[model samples]
Structure formats: structure tokens, C-alpha cells
Target: MSPVLPPALRGLPVAPVISHPVGQQTTVQPTTACELPQQSATGWLKEDSIASGVLIVLVLTGVQRLIGFVRSLLFCRWLEPDQLGQWDVAWGFLMLAAPLTVLSLPGTFGRYLEHYRAAGQLRVFLCRTAVVCLGLALVASGILLVMPEAFSWLIFGSGAQQQLIGPLAGTLLAVIAYNYLISLLTSLRTMRLVAVLETVNSAGFALAGGLLIYCWQRSAASAIVAYGSASLLCVVAATGWMQAIWQQAPQICPAIPQREFWAKLLPFAGWIMLVNLLTNLFMIADRYLVAQFAPGDSEARLALVGQYHSARVLPLLLASLASMLAAMILPHLSRDWEAGSRQQVSRRMNLGLKLLGLSLTAASAVLLLVAPLLFGLAFAGKYQQGLDILPWTLLSGVWFGAAALAQMYLWCAERAAKACLATALGLAVSVVLNLLLLPRMGLQGVVLAAA
Candidate 1:
């Protein structure tokens, strides 16, 4: 019925069908031609689950921070300047020591544990991390227990006013265990549990500290004992939670050999631990330096250190929010960067930096207005003298928090060496400034050095 068409124009030819015998099936899957999971419009923050996780962590952390602020306020109301100063210095030492006690497992554990969990090796990862932390904590606590006085000297030097070595060493051990358990739960994504741990810690501190002030002596030892008892209870609870998290972990597939797994963790964690220790040092170093270099008698210098610590509380409270955000974002940023999304990294950076600016600015302004009135009201007028130092200290915390956030990007990108070097550089500057300015300006000089 139709005219005969040329063979080439008749229809588009289909490719010849290819088939294989039963014995000729391909053995290896071709990964090169496949799209990566995190690409193709999928990403860390792009997922609903991840976004929700971050939000929940931030909210819970904010609640915990509020509780902590209340506890600190109560502590201020009860303790005098010299006592508070001694306590602050001791607490600073604990901060430096606590990270070391765990060998800096928390930050590094989250990254690897997340990967291991996805790979169905969570039990092995959790078991190994717990063992490592426990071993180190035991060793560290033994050393502290054997020579609490020597440890006290290392932290506060000679002529220390409140030499509560026994309680300090005991609290150190309890905190090390508590923190490790908390980190384990965080890696398990039991953020609510972590929040509860902090909530309980803060609430317990308030109840215990208030009780001690009301019934017992209002001294550094009493405060330490109160907090220590709270820490012990928390340690027990966290242990049970840790065990629960372990039970829920799927152990269907075997994990890698322990040596091979630890080899991967140690290199990453070693560098991070150094960075964390240095960062913590820089934070409380100013107070320690002021205590060391203030041009006055021991009692007077200690009082100044105490006042500076009081001023410092406001900034540290604001920094808690930033810390929560950074903690939540670290995993997301790591995933995004590893997925080759430089644009996402840049966006996160800008957003976080902006929030840091707004939060620090607003917090500083609010504190500037209320610092004098609140300090006088709550801290018995002893802290009003340091109102001038509060704003600058708060601003410096903004700087510190900003730097810490930047360092998180480095850690997620596996540039912990650079982060360590950067903190080392800051620590150097801090040392130089503290030495040069502290003698001339007293506590104000310490604030200047910190800034």
C-alpha cells in the first residue's frame, strides 16, 4: 500500500541484543559507573533525620546550659571571692586533665562510631572505646590518688588557699568516668540521655551545693564534695545507659581486627587530644596567669583571680550555645565535605560565623547592662569590682568560640594537625601577652591577654 522506502530511512535500528551463557556471568560489580549515596541531591543537612537530630541536640544543650547557669549563680551566692577563685582554678585544672584522662576519645569516637554503626560494627567500636577510656581513667586516677598534694601543687602552685586535694582527686576520677560514658552515649545518638546526664549533674550540683551551704561549711571542699557526689551518681546512670546502647547495637557482621581498628583511631585521636588540651589551656590560662603574676600579696592576688572568674561565667554561659551547635555540626560538616560539597561547607561556615557574631554581641550587651546589678545582688558586692572585665571577657569568648568552630571544620576535614598548630600559636600569644600585660594591669591585663 506504501511506496518502498530505503533501508536506512525505514526505521531507526535497535542495537543487537547481547546475551551470556549461564557460566559467563560477570563476577564484579562496576562501582565506577554508580552514583555515590551522598551525591545526587542527597546530603548531610539535606536529610530530615539529620536536621532533626541537630535541632534536638541544640535544644537539649540549651536547656542544660540554663541549668548550669543557675547552678553557677547559686554557687556565687554562697561562696566568697577567695574561695570561688580557688575553686575556679581547681576546676580549670580538671578541665585540662579530664580530656587527657580519656585520651580525647569523645570527639574522635563520634566520627568513627557513626561509620562503624552504619557498617554494623557498633558493638565492637563501643567495646573498644570503653576499654581504652576505662584503662586510662584507672591509671590517671591511681596516680592522682597516690599523690593528690603533688597534683594540687602542679595546678595551683604553693601557698594555695584551699588545698582540698582529696576531694579534687576523687572528683577528677568521677568526672573522667562520667565524661567518657556521656561521650559514648552521644556517639550512640542518644542525645536526650546526654542532655539528661547534664541536667542531673546540674540539678544535683544545685541541691548538694545548696545543702552544704545551708547545713555544712560553705567552703571549696564542700562544693567539690557536692559536685563529686553528683558526678558519682551520674557516672552510675551513664554506665547503665552505655550498657543499654551496647545491647541495641547490631552485631550481625564481624568488625575489623582490634589492632587495625585502633590503628585508625589513635592517629586521628592523638592529634585531636593535643588540640583539645591546648584549647582548654588557653581558655583558663588567663586566670591561672593572673593568679601567678598579679602584683600583690597571695590573698589579694587570689581574690583578683576569683573576681576574674566571676566575670568569666557570663561569657562561658553564652559559649555553651555555640559549643552545642559545633558539636552537632561536626558530623554533618564531615559528611558534607567528604561528599565533595565544598559549597555546603562554605554555607555552614558563613551561617555559623554569623550566628556567633549575633549571639556574642547580644549576650555582651545584655551582660553589660545587668552585670553590676546581678553580681552585687548574687555575689555579695564582691564581684561588682570586675564589671569592667566582664564585657571584654565575654568578647574574647566570642573569639574563642569562633576559633573553635573553625577548628571543627579542620577536624572534620582531617586537618587536626593544622588545628593543633593554630591553637598552639594562640597559646603562645596568650603566654606572651599574659607575661607582658599581667604585671602592668593586674586582672585587667589577664582579660587583655585572653582577648
Candidate 2:
């Protein structure tokens, strides 16, 4: 006597089945496509976890910047401007070489590693990435060793920088390898460990630099030795720690494919290479240009440029934290999008913006307010004359942080081409501006270009 079931319910016919008999209830049931796992305190979908993660990332980023600031101040007090300038020029060239060595692939490693982790294949991901990094490092090192003079003359002219060629080339491979390995752990979502490694590296560099200067006679060789050795040590410590954590708390399954990992990593690595090269080129080219075009006291001009550029460091550190937060949330965003969680994704985007905005605004304000005082303290009043760079540079932090966030979004969205385009444009603008402005404004021109 029960009414006929509608088409929508015809498959299960729950009403009719229930009306038939109580005993029949056990005989039939509606089919469910899937079941959700039990939610936990840190469930994947929760906003609270996202907020906490953002807060933690930002705080750690602040810590990293503070460490850098203190270290720079100490270095300035201990070393003369000309001495620091020489080190800076050598270091700038070294920074330029770094991206080339890795083919810039490690920059995007975190994104792919996130995908692998989400797919439950972590160990295979790490091993494969390591192989790619090592191979690239060795190749880059060999090339640098072969073409040492070409690099030396290009960055440091035919003068004293030629002397740095051996030391620079010798440690170049290890530095690149160490960086790639440290970055691998970061991709695995061990952010705390990543921050710790950076802190240790920074602290170690400062301590080593101090020891070399005051205790060991202000040798740039000693400073470089300490810096490279500390980087290698941190990489080793972090790698071992990551392996131990993996063993203790296995998070994902081994999913390395039968095909070699190098093949899979090459295309992505190439993209990373272009992105990093263009980005680093934009960052360091101005100093090189200053060294090239400044009419008198190239060292003084370079040091002035260094002072202005250093002002941006604190903001960059904070922005990096924002980038880290974005990176952490990206895999979750990708997973949610796949799972059709549109609402959750929107919420995450809004929350990420809000948190990042507040943190950046506050930091920028403090830097702007104390820029003169801080610059004076850090540079020992020698470069305090260029304090005007602080305000423009601090304001530029907003753009830097936003740009970084945008890059992260692009990276997660697999819009590397668009990210590259944006960066290329920014770099072009910077280069053109510097070329036009540096002769007129000298160090201030470089600051304008950087801004």
C-alpha cells in the first residue's frame, strides 16, 4: 500500500524498503560512494590550524630577520667598510653563481614535493630530488672550475677578485648541494627544522666571521671558510634530523616510479633555473653596475649600495615567512581543489591575505620608524648618510611581500611562466631604472632601482 518511490530514490527505495518490514531493514541499505575519515584536533579542513600555522611561520620569519640584523650590525662594528665591500662584491658574484649551479630547480622543489607527499610518496621523492641536486651541483662545480677567470673578470674585474676564484669555485659545489638538501626537508613540511637550520647557519656565520676577524686576523679567507663550513654542517644536521623524524613518524608511502627521477625532475628544474637566474640577476646586478659605473671610489659606491640594499633585508625576511606560509598551505589548497572544496579554498585565501597583510604592515611600520637609528647602529655612521634609502625601501617591502605571495600562488597554480614573466618585467624595470639613474644619483640611484 506504500506510494511508489520517485526516480531519485528508486535505486534504494528506502521508504518502501522500510515499510515492507522491520526485519527487512537489515537486508538493504543505501550505497555511499565514500566515507570521510574521522576529524582530529588538527583536521585538514580546519581554519584554526591554518591560522596557527600562519602565526607560527610569521613569528619564525621575524626571528630569522632579527638574527640577520644583529649579525650585520656585529659585522659592521668589527670590519671596515672597504673590507666589507670587497667581501660583498665577492659574495654578490658567488650569489649569482648559485642559481646557475642548481639550474634553479630547487626553488620549485617544494611545490612538487608537496604533491608527492599528498599522493603518499615521500621517501621516493626525497631520494630522487637528492640525486638530481647532486648531479647538477657536480656539473656546475666542474664548469665553474674550468671557467674561473671568465667569472672572476665578469664580476670583480681583472683585479683582486681574480684571487677569490679558487676559494669561490672550490666551495661552490658544496654550497649548492647543501642548499638543495636543506630545501628538500623544507618541502617535506618540516618548517620548524628549516627555520632552525637557517638560524644555525646564520648564527654560525656570524660567530665564524667574528672569530675570523677579531680572533683570526680579519681574513676574508677565514670568513668564507667558516661560512661554507657552517652551511655544510647545517645541511648535514638537518638531513639527518629529517630522516630520524621520518623513521619515527612515517607520514607518507614510498612512491618512486620505476623510471629514473632525473628525467622527471629535469623539465621542472629548467623552469626553476630560469626563474632563479632572472630573479638573482635583478637583485645583484645593481651592485655590479654600481661597481662598474661609479666614477670614484668604487668600493665606497659599492658599500653605499650595500647599505641601502641591506635595509630591505629585514622586510625580505618577513616576506619569506609569508612565502613559507603560502607554500605550506599550497598542497592543502591543491588537495582541497581536487576534492571540490571551493568554500574552504576561498576561506583559506582570505585568511592568508589578512594574516600576511597585518604582519607585513606592522613590520614595515617599525622599520620605517627606526630606519635612521638602526642604519646608524648597523653601519657605524659611515653609511648613515644614505638613510634616505630606508623609507622608500621600507615602503617597497609591501610590494616585495605581495610579489612573493603572488609568486607562491603562481607556483601552486603551476603558472611558472606567468611568474617568470612578472619577475622578468620587474627585473627589466629595475635594470633600466638603474642604468638611467645610477650616474645621476650614484648609490641613491641603486636604491631607487631596488625600490
Best by TM-score: 1
Clash totals in order:
0, 1
Q: Estimate each model's TM-score.
A: 0.78, 0.70
- Per-residue alpha-carbon lDDT of model 1 for 1-451, expressed as tens digits? 0001001101100000011222353343223322222122122212235566666657766766787787788778888877777778777777777777776766565556666755556666777877877788778878877776676666665435435777877888777777666665555555556666767887888889889865898777788888788889988866654554555556455547878998877765665565566667767777788666677765676678778878878887767656656665777786787688989998998898788778778878888898878887877777765676887888777876786566567656555456557767878898899899888877778787778
Per-residue lDDT over 1-451 for candidate 2, one digit per residue giving the tens place of the 0 to 100 score: 0011111101111122112232333332212311222222122222234455556556766776677777667666666655565566666666667756556566555445555544445456666656766787677767667787786666655444555666676666657766776565545555455556767877777777778778875544555666677777777776556555344333444445556555665665565556556666666677777766665664665566456545555565565555565555666776676577868777777777777777788888887777667667766676553466666665566666656554544544445567667778887888898889988987667777777
Distance from true position, residue 296, model 2, in Å? 2.8
User: lDDT of each model, Cα atoms only?
Assistant: 0.67, 0.59
Model 1, stretches more than 4 Å misplaced? 1-48, 114-129, 159-163, 246-258, 325-359, 404-414
Which 10-residue window in model 1 sums to the lowest lDDT?
8-17
Best candidate per lDDT, number? 1
What's the CA RMSD for each of the models?
15.3, 13.9
> Measured by TM-score, how close is model 1 to the native structure?
0.78
- Cα displacement (angstroms), candidate 1, residue 62, comes to 1.8
